[model samples]
Target: MANSLLKHPDFMRLWSAQIGSAFGSRITRTVLPIIAILLIDADPNEIAILSALSFAPGLIVAFFAGGFIDRNQKRPLLIVTDLVRAALIFSIPLAAFFGSITMMQLYIVAALVGAATALFQIADNAYLPRLVEKDQLVEANSKLESTDAVAEAAGPGIAGLLVSLVTAPVAMMVDGFTYLWSALMLTRIKKQEPEKQARDENDNLLSDAIAGLKACTNHPVVGPILAAETLLAFFGGTYLTLYMIVGLRTIGLDPFTLGVIISLGGVGGFLGAMAAAPMAQKLGLRTTLLITLALGQLSNFFIPLAAAMPEFGAAFLALQQIAGDIFMTIFVIQALSLRQRVMDENLLARANATFQLTTGIAVTISALLAGPLTIIFGIAPVLWGAAIGSMLALPIMWLAKEEKAA
Candidate 1:
């Protein structure tokens, strides 16, 4: 009974908007790299730089963004970010029309889009609980995630086809348009949002933000998870930065085939999301997260090994694609649910922002490291490092037993 969040009109609107946006987002994800690789001949270093630029703003602004979000209306920010992203993404197509598109423009677009993504994610996650009952959080998340998996699974294939037909630039306009559609859907939803709490005129923004960080870092359950999550992001960042390079240059897959391979991963994520609740029930939430993290990190090792042996690279990457998504999805769902269960509702945005900030830092480090390391030792060694470094989080997880709160 608690699981039927979709029956609610507001949630349905959010989900509907999300469906189009998710698929469109995938087109943007796939096309950008395809443009860099197939169209403009971007080298490994350039691709790494593009990846770095994409998420850099999160590290810069995410720490304090939480306090600001908590003090204001969320829906407007979400709408504005969506529209801004639409404009930024559309600029690429506009420039291509005038024969003025450059790698520089792509870098700028990626950074701006990433910054918007950070804000949207924090605001959106905070907003969802307002739309449903507390008992339904996991179920709401699961439904959202499962449908998201479906869109992601389909997205790459659609993106591949679109890019094949119209080239990366023209095809990518679909993503820009989708953002506009998402904003339109946001406007259609009529749920009255909770009034924003007025901030104390004397409150220090940094201190308020730090309080959220303390909430996460001081909590028994979340503390270790935060540590593990950051490591996962860092190592995962390294893997992602090198992943396309190994796929295109090392194993030699075409764009469409590569897209198909990525879509196959969505199958694994879909299965994992469906299983997340049951797994939490059976293993206990904390244990479930530990197990998933271990498995996800384990799957990452096969990634580099696949590249090392080209004959098996495609097969290995395919397995990792599926396996990695499954483990990570389960880990993410349970871990986040734990936060919702424990954290104060008022602090939800800040807690989530704090959470994002740490991962952002990890991502920044990984991005910065990936370019130089891959340039020097090549993809295999760096991948090996990423796999080994992921294990550094296990000790933290092992000690993260649940304790009763005062």
Candidate 2:
């Protein structure tokens, strides 16, 4: 039987770290684009490039990092990466203070932070199995994601407020501080991590990355879900690259109202996190996954629709945030639990790396394409195409045979 996450101090520390990190991520997501639009007067192409830079490094490095993560302890990597991200974020505000912050600097920061986040996430996925019994993964993930959901709920609003009051670049200082907080919380964990097994002398990053990629593709359940997720990731990139521009510039919502609309997603995410396990229990994991995945993809239509109707933009966006986040959160929780339950502990990091690699590639391509597509066809059609592309994931997922959770 799984122990209560509420009673686990080390898990709580991990969860707390996630809280700060999640909030920091949310703020960065909000402010970076706004800074590009408002401060730098960048066009859609530049915004798309900014978005692409964030995921491009992960596409390049995550597979190798996954290999490295499996050969080392995760805790130190987690801490160091957090510090690095904090430093990177702090550099932005410092530059802004001197009135020298530029789109190139923002691009560099986003890329570096993306690479660090890729490492942190892979290590985190592998580390979790070591921290708790296999049976506890769902609950543990639920707790962690719930914290993220709370941050998601409030982070953007706080970011918007800070941006409104202090300006966008200076507002990034809050994200830097959150990373420092994350690092501090991580230091408080007392759990002794299991030592990595000694690798063969012939083993290297390339071989390990290849092995990871093979493992994920050869697995029955993992392979299909990975494909589906890659498709969704591509479509998701398109939405993200355009959403801020569409809202702030196209539909003309103020930053605070935009933040509030986005925060509704966090509220929905919290509800989804809380409901994931229960829904899995009641509906079975397969059914719940299908329902949520379909709903999540379908919900994205609202964005393009919102752009088409500026008068009702806020209402459409709010609905999109709430319904879309709820479904996506539920899908993510159940999907992650399913992956963790099935993969061997030693291979988990590599498998996750492979997953990240594919999705990162997809996202990068989508982000790069989104701007060009928008320039050619305009915002509404590009978004409509993205929404249509995202729905393709449902059939791919539907074709995969479900595995009973261990």
Candidate 3:
């Protein structure tokens, strides 16, 4: 089965691009914050805004990007977005070298990258179904997910080393090269299918977007999935911010130790993605999702407790990170596979857009509140609070009958 999956040419091409992009993204995800904090000397509030700006464009561009992607060729969209992001990110190092880099420039670059990323995401999800057979979907997604897991595990450590060696801004240049590499790989792939002509007949982008929104809102499975994902994002976002703060400030772990802890989760994610197919076959999708969801929520409690207890905090944090990553990998692979299987190809991009938009909104809100909430309630309280919020999603999952279809 693995051999067959690995042999599929289109999947291989897509997987390569995804791996390259994932590596690049991890560099930014780690180095960008470090730059803001260490280089720019940003306050907590400014850091929060930086995070929010990075995600905010998805909320604004997702629906429109979906509509646009649905009407166009996926390959070109992916290539163009990757190229644009590459150019934008490459400018960071250039501006820094010239001693002209500003916080405003950073914000603008992040936001613009986010916008281009929105289009790429929509196009990528929509393009997947066309690239592989339906039965191979899970396997293909697993391979991609596994690559992401590997990237997550390796990218930050590399970024940390690179930043230590050559500063944060210079480290970003590595990601710029990765994006260019991804774009080149994408361009080399031959997509025989022509672009969809559906939007050419329609003159009104607004009307089309609204209709796409309605479709997602009306879909029984997709709507609930979006709701659950939103809840997860809300809690997960806050938990992430708190996790970093707690680890660095409260627990007093050094950067290297923190990186290792984060990397451990990526190892778990890789294992989880590798195990997803068997687990799904054993537990069924519905059972697996519910179990993982519960486990995911339970996992967050460890973070706060880890923060409060110094002696065993590192171990607890590592365990929590692993559990969360495993749950997330399983949840994403199954949920996305189910979505792709059920939704019409024509509407897939819009459905994915809706999910992305919900996540973006939830993350934005969480980023905004996380700083203030941490200050008011402390990082431990914020962590526990987000854990509680995650549990709220279980009822939504139950009420929506997510188990029935599976």
* Predicted structure with the largest lDDT when compared to the true one: 2
Clashes of each: 0, 0, 0
| lDDT string, candidate 1, 1-406, tens digits | 6357657788788877777677767777778888888767899889978877776776555787787877777788888888988999999889888888789989999888888878888888877777767666677777778877888898877887888898888887988988888888888888888788887876677887888898888888788888888888888889767888888889998866777787778998899888887777777766787789899888888888977997888888889989988988888877776677677777888899988888877776786689899889988999999999998888888878763211
Number of colliding residue pairs in model 3? 0
Ordered list by TM-score, greatest first: 3, 1, 2
Model 3 C-alpha lDDT versus the unseen true structure:
0.81
Query: 238, model 1: CA deviation in Å?
Result: 2.7
Please, what are the lDDT tens digits per residue for candidate 3 over residues 344-403?
887778778878877877876886699898889887778878888888888776654443
Among these predicted structures, which one has the highest TM-score? Answer: 3
What tens-digit string does per-residue lDDT give for candidate 2 at 346-387?
A: 788898998888887887788779999999999999999999
**Pairs clashing within candidate 2:** none
Q: How does candidate 2 fare on TM-score?
A: 0.87
Model 1 ranges off by over 4 Å: 33-50, 95-105, 167-169, 248-257, 370-381, 403-406
Cα-based TM-score, every candidate: 0.87, 0.87, 0.90
Clash number for model 2? Answer: 0
